[model samples]
Structure formats: structure tokens, C-alpha cells
Target: MARIITLTVNPAIDKSTTVAGIGPNTKLRCTQPTFDAGGGGINVSRAIKKLGGTSLCSYFSGGPSGAYLKQLLDEKDIEQSITPIKGFTRENLAVTDTSTNQQYRFGMPGPPIQEAEWQNALKQLELQLNKGDYLVASGKLPPNIPDDFYVKISRIAENKEALFILDTSGEALIKAAKSRVYMLKPNLAELGALCGVTSITDLDLKSLAQEFLENNDCQILVVSLGPKGALLVTKNEMVQVPAPVVHQKSTIGAGDSMVAGMVMSLIWGKSLVDMVRYGVACGTAATMHHGTQLCIKEDADKLYEWIKQQAPILETN
Candidate 1:
């Protein structure tokens, strides 16, 4: 079996709570908070396990919060590989307003990483990756980390002959686009930025996607369209994967869940179309729950069937 490894440079301990209502400058009571292991790659690994798949979750661990994060994942039997650091890992919070069904999220900055710390992380990741492996690296760059951090990982993947799936934004996205990437999961805004445009309408969505694939070495480009599903673009094929609507509670971790589903589909030797459809299914399923909870297997499986029945808007060049 080809190994599946996920690397989250900036990991977190996610805390979620529910309050009766939210108001400005007023005291409100909240329910007991629930804590979970978080960050992009961590969530992907967690979702994969939820779907009865396994992945090695690798991340930076620092301070007591990082320890707690590891403990949370350990409880779920999600295998983890840690890279010790001097700075504390971040802790993010989400508070749900019961009255309005609105979720407010607060994100903290990750601790600044020293040059040696990040360099060591790269060395460890390169050592762990092997040919035919699937390496999923997700989340934003932290303080003191270079924008080209992922570019280095891309090179490592290229040398190792591993498939690199990247999910990130900002300058990191801009630089990594020029590197060798097997797949990219960027939101519509990020995709537009890659195309060097400020806006993209439905009329030109396919064109921009084509342009991205043509101008870069990316084999697969998955532009997440939120509730509308995602657009999957390859060298010769482009299709809009439709998502089934559901009662949405929270949108956290939806993208990571989507990536996890797609990776699992690949592991199962499914076709490209099936892989993206299952990804859309998992993304939609993530919205049906509160907090940072990802897609459950039952929900994702049911949604996958619904997505398969719906006709995909497609084209083949």
C-alpha cells in the first residue's frame, strides 16, 4: 500500500462552545467547550479515519497546548508524527450562537518558528516521504516562515516521485503555483489570484481554470466553490461538481474533508470523476454539523450517492 502522509506546519487545538446568544459588550453564558485536534492536515487525517481510512498525521508540537492537541488525536486513534518546536502551537476557538445559528470563529497566530526549526521540519518530511506516496500539506504559513515554504516541499515531492496535494493561500499559493504540484485545492478567490485577476464570473470559470492548468505544472486543480460545490480541472477535462444542499450548521474543516475524501478515492483506485464527486460529498457533509467536526462516513456516503445521480456540467478538450 502506498503511504499517506499529511503535514500541518501550523497545527492547533480547536475549542468549540455554544452560547444562548451573542451581543456586543454584554456578558453571555456558554456551554462547556469541546476540544479537538485541528489545523488543515490534521483535520484531513481525522476525516480520513472517520471514513475508515488511515493516514500519518505529522505536525509541529510545542508547549502544553500542542501536547493537548496530540492527546486529543491519540484518543481518536489517529496516528501522528511530531516535530518538536520551541514555540507554542496555536489554539483556535469557535462559538456558536444557538438563537441565530451563527458561528463566530477566532483564530490566533501561530508561534514564530526559528530558521533551524523550520529547516529541520523540511528534513524530517523529506525523510518520511517516499516514491508513490501521497503527501497532503495544508494550512497557512506561520510567523517567521517563508512564503516559499511549500515550494521546498514541492521540490522534495518531485525528487521523491510522490504526489503532492497542497491547500494554502496568500503569497505561499503564489510561489508554490510555479513549482511541481500534483494537485492544488484553492478557493475561488485564490484561483482568481493565480490567474492574475481580481474577479472571475461563472462565464469565465472554465477558461481561467484551463489557463491555470496550462500555465503551470499542476495535474489537477480543484477550485472550491463553497456551497455550489467545486470545479475540477485537468489537462484535457473540466467539470463542475455539484454539491447536494443540506441544513448547514458550520463550515469549518469542509475543505480538508473534501481533500481527505479525494485522497481516499485515489487510494481505492477510483476514476478522476468519482474522486472529485466523493470530495464534493464530503465537503457538503461537513457543513451539516457544528464546530470543527468533519464529515461522518454515513453522511458522506449518502451524499456521494446523491452527487453521483446529479449530472455534472463537463467538457473534454
Candidate 2:
């Protein structure tokens, strides 16, 4: 089996709960909260585990919260490789308003990482990544972490002949897009940023994707279209896999789950079309649950079958 390795630079202890209502200046009674390991790559690893696949979850950790994050992943039976750091891990909160069934999420900025700490993380990647391995790096760069952090990781993956799959945003994402990668999962806004534009109209989406591919060393581009599903583009193929709509409880972790699904499909020796279709299934399945539960194997399996029954919308440039 090909190795799957996920790296989350800004891991968090995600706490979620439900409240009767939401208002300012009033004490609201909330239900007991649930805590889980979080961040982009970590969620991907958890989703893979949920789908009965294995991946090595790697990240920087420190302080009590970091220990708790490790404990949570352990409870889930997900393997981990952690690098010690001085800064404490961050925690995020999600509150569901039971009255309106709406979720309010509060995200915190991650602690600053020292130069040595981040460099050590890169060193660890160099040591752990093996050829043909899939290196999935996601999430934002923590405070003080360089914008080109993923770009550095891309170098290591290239030297090791590992496949680098990136899902991130902002300056870090812009910098990494300049390097070679096996795949990139960026939403519409991030794609626009990569194209040096403020927005991407659907009219020229394929053309822009083609232009990006032509200029970069990236092998695959998966642009997420939220509820409409995702567009998969490569040098030879272009496809739009429609997502199966579901009663969405929360959309948290959907993108990470999608990445996990696509990578797992590749590991299973499935075709690229199946990879994106399964990815869409997993992404949609994630919305069916609340509080970062990610996608269940059964739900994704059913959704994948449904997606296959419908023809994929194709595009040409």
C-alpha cells in the first residue's frame, strides 16, 4: 500500500457544543462540549481513518493542549509523528444554535513558531517521507511561520519522489503554488488568488485552470465549488463531479474529508474520475454531520454510487 502522510502546521483542539439560542449580553446555557483533534491535515487523517484507511498524521505540538490533541488522535487509532515546539497549540470553538440549527464557529490564530521549530519540522519531513508516498500538507501557517513553508515542504517531497497534495490559502498558498506539486485543492477564492486575480467567473474558469496548469509544475488541480461540487483538471482531462446534496448539519472539515477521499481512491488504484467523484461524495457526506465528525465510510460509499449513476459534467478549453 502507498503511504499516506498528512501534516498540519496549525493543529487545534476543536471544542463543539450546542446552545438553546444565541444573543449578545446574555448568559446562554450550553450542552457539554466534545473535543477533537483538528486542523486541515489532521482532519484528513481522521477522515481517512473513518473511511477505513491508514495515514500517518504529523504536526507540531506543545503544551497541555497539544498533549490532548495527541490523546484524541490516539483514541481514534490514527498513527502520529509529532515534533515538539515551545508554543502551545490553539483551540477552536463551534456553537450550534439549537433553535435555528445554525452553527457559529470561532477560530483562533495559532501561536508563533520559532525559526528553528519550523526548520525542524521540515527536517522531519525530509526524514520521514519515502518515495511514492503521498504527502498531504494543509492548513494555514502559524504566526511567525514563513509564507513559503509549503514551498519548502514541496522541495522535500520532490527530492523524495513523494506526491505533494496541498490545501491552504493566503500568502502561504500563493507562494507554494509556484513550486511543483502532485495535486492542489483550492476553493474558488484561493484559485483566483493563484491566478493573480480577485475573482474567477465561471465563464473562464476552465481557461484559467488550463493556464495555471500550463505555467506550473502541478499535475492536478481540484477546485472546490462548494455545494455545486468540484472541478478536476489535468493536462489531458477536465471534469466536473457534482456533489449529492444532503441535509447539512455543518460544513466543517468537508474539504479535508474530500482530500482524504481522493487520496484513498488513488491508493485503492481507482481512476482519476472515480477519485474526484468519491471525493465529492465524501465532502457532501461530511456536511451531513455536525462538529467536525467528517465523512463516514457508509455514507460516502452510498454517495459515490449515486454520483456514478449521474454523468459527470465535462468541459473543454
Candidate 3:
């Protein structure tokens, strides 16, 4: 078993294509579509593989779409464990308008998971996790599942003495943060939501991040700042990782790529500052491509070196 295991409860087959122009009606013909296996944890697994690391991806599945998702992972040589379900997995679409260089994304709500199916997923996770392992539970909970689902997973991780890394939103994220989690990667807006504030200014961001770490069982909080950069906050210190400017292609799977970089860095025993630097590098590299391509190892490595030379850690007071 790989030391890292990822769980994506709401997985999807991501289909992307391009159109010359996107206008209302008038028969807009799209180019040939490309499909990729996606979901928060699955994308993390894919990015890890791209970074020359290995992890087991566990997710729910059913129907032809689910089988296709597994096939996509197999093609990428990513290891996976599937929990069969009754509902077919959902598919999301992304159409890029070539003329305007604008990408329009359409996300679908995943199929509702039955009680037994979700419980079975938990049982599978319990079987896979071990001491000192990293369990990354990401993506949203499917409809009809309880909001406290990740909370239960957190408990399992605690019992196994595994580190739980959570990347999610809304109620699922809110409830799970109260449990024993090792880290959280929330975007600026999601961090604002977690802090119960409608807005978070630059001055208050670090303070709020510090407060969350102090209060919650979560040991590390990484607030992704998109084009600007990311903030890595712990109980002891805070470091701001600046992102290098690059030709933007697509933002899909960027966050998962960032998480993958940081986890791989941790496994390699890099410093926390270097971990966030590599994470920002992977995320920026992911945007230098289209669709769900994620980060390439060469690009990420170059960016990591560039960031290290130009960006320095600012020790927060």
C-alpha cells in the first residue's frame, strides 16, 4: 500500500472541448472532446503521479461513466480502489471560446449516495489507513449524504494515527475542521467563509488564519491566494509564498495540484516554507496548460527553483 491515500466522494468524468465562438443559438460547433478522471482527491493522485510520486485513490463509482473513470486512471497508471454504488457518476463540461480565450465551465451535482454505499466507503478507508499515513479526503459530499461524513473519516484517521488533510467547502468543510485534521487548503473565499467573515482584508488574513489554527485541531492552514500567491500559517509562524506570473490556460485541478506538491514535499521531509513554495509552483504550472492536464514535473521543478530564488519567507510577528 502507498503511504498516501486519497478519498474523493464525488468523482466526475471531466469532458472538455473548444469552440471558435460561443454565442446564443446559431449552432456553435465544438471540436472533439477530451475526457479526464477528476474529483478533488483523484486529481491530487494524478498530480502526485505527475510529480513522480504514488498514492492510492479511493472513490465511489457505478455505471459506464464510473468504469470509464477507472479506465482513465488506469491509462495514467494511477492506482485506485473503487466502492461500487447504484447511481452513475456525474460528468462535468468545460468549453473554451478560442476567439475570446475565455473558458466556460459547467459543473454537475453528483449522484446521490445511499447510506450503505457511504458506510462501505468508510469501511474501505478504515481498512486502507495505517499509522503515519496521509489520508486526503477532498471534494464535496454527494446529495443525500450527511454533512458530518468527513467528521467520521477524521475520527478514523485519528484512531489509525494517520494525518488527515481536508480540502472541501461549505458545511462538510465546516464540520470536518472541528475534528482532528492535520491540514486544510482553503482558497481565500473559502477561508473567509470558515472564519465567518464576509470579507478578509490583507491585514486581517494572517490574523484569522492564526486564530483558526489556534482554535481548531487542524495544525496547518494554507490559504490559496490565486494569482497573487498562498499563505502558509501554523501555530508558530506564517509564510507568504508568491506565485510567478505565467500564461494562464485553465484553473481546473490547480488546487489539487497544489495539495499534491505540498504532500509530496512533506513526505520528502522538506521544510514547511519549501513545501508551500513547491505547492505554489505546481499550482501555477497547472494553469500554464488547458483543461484538466494538471502540473508537469519539469515545469513544476523549474518554477520551484525560480520561486526559491525570487521569493523569500516573511516571518510574521
Candidate 4:
């Protein structure tokens, strides 16, 4: 089995709860909060496990909150590697309004990472990665970390001859796009940014995606389209994978679930067409749960079967 490793530079302890109503200057009663270990790569690792796969989750740890995050992952039986830091980890809150069925999230800026801390993380990741491994680096950069941090990680992946999968945004995404990346899972907005355009229409999407793969060092581009599903673009093929409609309870962790699905498909040596289809299934399945529960294997399997029956929108542009 090929070793899979996920790197989350900024991980968090997520607290989720539901309230009857949300209004200013009102004392609304909230249900008991539930906690989960969260971050882009962390959630991907969790989703992979839920789908009956294993991955090594490596992240920066500090203070009590960081310890709690590790404990949460430990309870789930997910293997992990911890890099100690001086600053405490962050916490995020998700509150769902029962009145409007809308969720409000409050995110905290993680502790400022010291120069040594960030560099140490890179060294640790380099040591853990091996040839033919999959190195997944996701989530936002913490305070004080340079925007080119992921670009450096891309170099490390290259040195190890590992496949680098990046899911991030803003300058970080743009900087890393210049490096040799095996895969990128970006939403339409992120894709537009990569193309140096403010907007993208349905007609221009295929051309732009093809242009990205042609111009950049990325091998695969998966542009997520929310409820519409995702567009998978490669050098030789381009297709739009449609998503199945489901009762949406929350949108959190959907993208991570999708990445997990696609990576697992690659591990299984599935075709790119089927990989994107399964990815769409996992993302759609994630919406069927409340809070950050993510996708269940049974739901993903059923949705994947349905998606397999649909003809993908092939683009030859």
C-alpha cells in the first residue's frame, strides 16, 4: 500500500451547536456543543478513515487545545504525528439556527508560528514523506507564516518524489501553482483567481481549465462547483462530474470529503473519470449530515453508484 500523509499547518478543535433562533440582543438557548478535530488536511484524513482507508495525519500541536485535537483524532483511531509549537492551537465555532436553517461560523486566527516552528514542520514533513507517497497539504496559513509556505512544501514533495495535492486559497494558492503539484482541488472562485480573472462563465470554464493544466505544473485540476458538482481537467481529458441532490444539513467538510474520495480512488487505481464521479458523490453525501459529521461510507457508495450511471459532460476544448 502506498503511504498517504496529510499535513495541516493550522489545525483546530471545532465546537458545533444548534440554537433555536439567532438575533441581536437576545438570549437564545443553544443545544450542547459537539467537538471535532478540524482543518482541511485533518478533515481529509478523517474522511478517508470513514471511507475505510488509513492515512498518517501530521500537524502542529500546542497548548491544551492542540492536545485536545490530538486526543480527538486518537479516539477515532487515526494515526498522527505531532510537531510541538510554542503558541496554543485555535478553536472554531459553528452555530446552526433552527429558525432559518442557516449556520454561522466563527473562526479564530491561529497562534503566530515562530520562524523555527514553521521550518521545523517542513523538515518533519520531509522526513515523513517517501517516494511514491501522497503528500496532502491543505488549510489556511497561520499568522506570520509567509504566503509562499506551501510553495516550499511543494519543493519538499518534489524532492521526495511524492505526489503533492494542494487545497488552499489566495496568495498561497497562486504561489504554489508555480511549483510541481500532482493535483489541486479548488473551487470555481479559486480557479478564477488562478486564471488571473475576476469571473468565469460556463462557456469559458473549459478553456480556462485546459489552459491551467497546459500552462501550470499541475497534473490534475478539480474545480469544485458546489451543488453543481465538479469539473475535472487533465492534459488529455476534460469532464464535468454531476453531483447528486441530497438533504443538505451542513456544508462543512464537504470539500475535504471530496478530496478524500478522489485520493482513495487514485490509491485504488481507478480511472480519472470514475475518480471525479466518486469525489462528487462523497461531497454530495457530506451535505446530508449536520455539523461537521462529514460523509458516511454507505451514503457515498450509494451516491457513487448513481453517479456512475450518468454520462459526464465531456469537453474537448
Report lDDT (CA) for all predictions: 0.93, 0.94, 0.93, 0.93
* Each candidate: RMSD: 0.8, 0.9, 1.0, 0.9
Q: Give the TM-score of candidate 3.
A: 0.98
Provide TM-scores for the models.
Answer: 0.98, 0.98, 0.98, 0.98
**Tens digits of per-residue lDDT for model 3, 22-89:** 98969989999999999999999999999999999999999999999999999999989999999999
C-alpha lDDT of candidate 4 relative to the true structure: 0.93
Error of 3 at 275 (Å): 0.6
Error of 2 at 139 (Å): 0.5
- How do the residues 1-317 of candidate 4 rate in per-residue lDDT, one tens digit apiece? 68889999889999999998898997888999999999999999999999999999999989999989989999999999988999999999999999999999999989999999999989889888999999998898989899999999999999989999999998999999999999999999999999999989898988898998989999999999999999999998889998988889999999999999999999999999899998999999999999999889999999999998898788664
Best model number under lDDT: 2
Query: What local lDDT does model 3 show for residue 155?
Result: 99
User: What are the clashing pairs of model 4?
Assistant: none
After superposition on all CA atoms, how large is the RMSD of candidate 1? 0.8
Sliding window of 10 residues with minimal summed lDDT for model 2: 308-317
User: What TM value does model 1 have?
Assistant: 0.98
lDDT minimum window of 10 residues, candidate 3: 308-317
